[model samples]
Target: MRKALTLLGTGLAAALALTACGGGNNASAPSAAATLDPANPTTVTVGATPTPQAKILEFVDQKLAKEAGIDLEIKEFDDYQTPNIALSDGSLDANYFQHLPFLEDQMKTKGYKFEHGAPIHIEPYAGFSAKHKKISEIPDGATIAITNDPGNQPRALKLLESAGLLKDIKDDSSALTLSDEQNPKKLKFEENQPEILLPLVKDPKIDMAIINGNYILDAGLNTDDALVVESVKDSPYGNFLVWRAGEETPAIAKLEELLHSPEVKAYIEKTWPNGDVTPAF
Candidate 1:
């Protein structure tokens, strides 16, 4: 599943690429190092979404676990809220959907603790102009459609800021809302799930959309279609696994290691293709 940014490392593995899953029967499991106990069953239950993270898990789950001598179990959740709660309640071992910033925000609002290691992947917020294929084609004052959710709206506006559609609403703003925008294009903000914005693009009324990678994937739209995209040069939105605070399981370590393994890198290369997603190992 896709997590909002704070819910945390590989360090910046080359700018910022949205990270997650992979596949293989057995190329070879890394030799059990002195670091972990092989005999103890280190099974972890991770929660995720469908494409590319969930799709990624389906690919890597079995081989990575068996190879590591750990049994990895992944649970799928289409909605964003459950996984975090599941992690909190002891219903899950860990979750692999949100980014550090998103998780941190969720923790503050919900009063739960979640953290990650390294930045995993970034699903860039791309500006998709229904009328134009290229940024140059966007006429002045076009009515762009951006998600209206409090958390995601600010993110969408940041993309608008980057696309030169709006001026800085806040200097140190890591997140944004419509109130922050100077409205260069006078774009009408339509708050809704990221997916809804795509269909609106079909209507002549909607000029553009700041679509997230998940919605882009759901719509089968490609990077080439985006008039603008999130600048990952120093982006903070990398997907990571969130374990309960004060509890670090051996399975968590195994899962983390496998995430950065050669298998996952290969999977990231195969799945994202556009180099948008990478295992933050």
Candidate 2:
């Protein structure tokens, strides 16, 4: 029997309500300056995924934000789409659950005008299997699970390419997709939302699943158990903090500074010592 896992639900209705109130594309413009005095703490509401992104913010809120005159309020989102939607609709001050590739794609396709801070950390993509102990053991025509999002679909396909399961992936990000001709192993792919891939890997029919590192941690799966892991050196998939363009305030800048601070880097290293989550700074 597959073990049950708890997944956080997206705030779709709240986001919709906010969007309907002129908060969608033409939301209220950000305040021209910090509304609060520098000496007073300003509250910044952020949306994030449940695992490392939110966990990292909780650490900063508890250990560092007070001294910086910032009060961090984090709203956790399970699905990848909602955080950006919430940010676009003014339901959040900022969000911190995506990489540059994903961020760029969202901006281009959704017409969201956003800016992001420097990369904070890299959650190395990995492939896990309950049916096979090694990549070599995954036979031809096996069913593999991957994320359906355009930004991450290429990543899953790239991981498969690196493992020698596929070949000749298009260099252009938008053109990449699952191709039987490219897949030498004849591996069948099952696509789902990023959050669902972890649970699907446990299904007896799934031969393997390429999962995001944060999801791997959320499911309490050891990174060491991965049959193959993406190399972190110069990896372009580092996750970072994002906010509305031209809306950045002192409080948001402070939070960005704190995120790249040595303290936060140390905390990430300590918490995920196995290199599942590595500081990009």
Residue-by-residue lDDT tens digits, candidate 1, 1-281: 22232222223311121121111111122222444545765666777766677766666665565666566566766545666666776767777777755666566656675546555567777887668877766677676776643446667777777777777755334322334347655556555555457787776877777776766776788876678888776766777766766555566766767777787878788878785565555
Which candidate has the top score in lDDT?
A: 2
Q: Mind sharing the TM-score for model 2?
A: 0.86
- Model 2 gets an lDDT of 0.79
* Model 2 regions more than 4 Å off: 1-39, 171-181
- Candidate 1 worst ten-residue window by lDDT: 18-27
Tens digits of per-residue lDDT, candidate 2, 1-87, equal 011122435455334423432111222323335544447788899888878989899999989888888888888877787777778
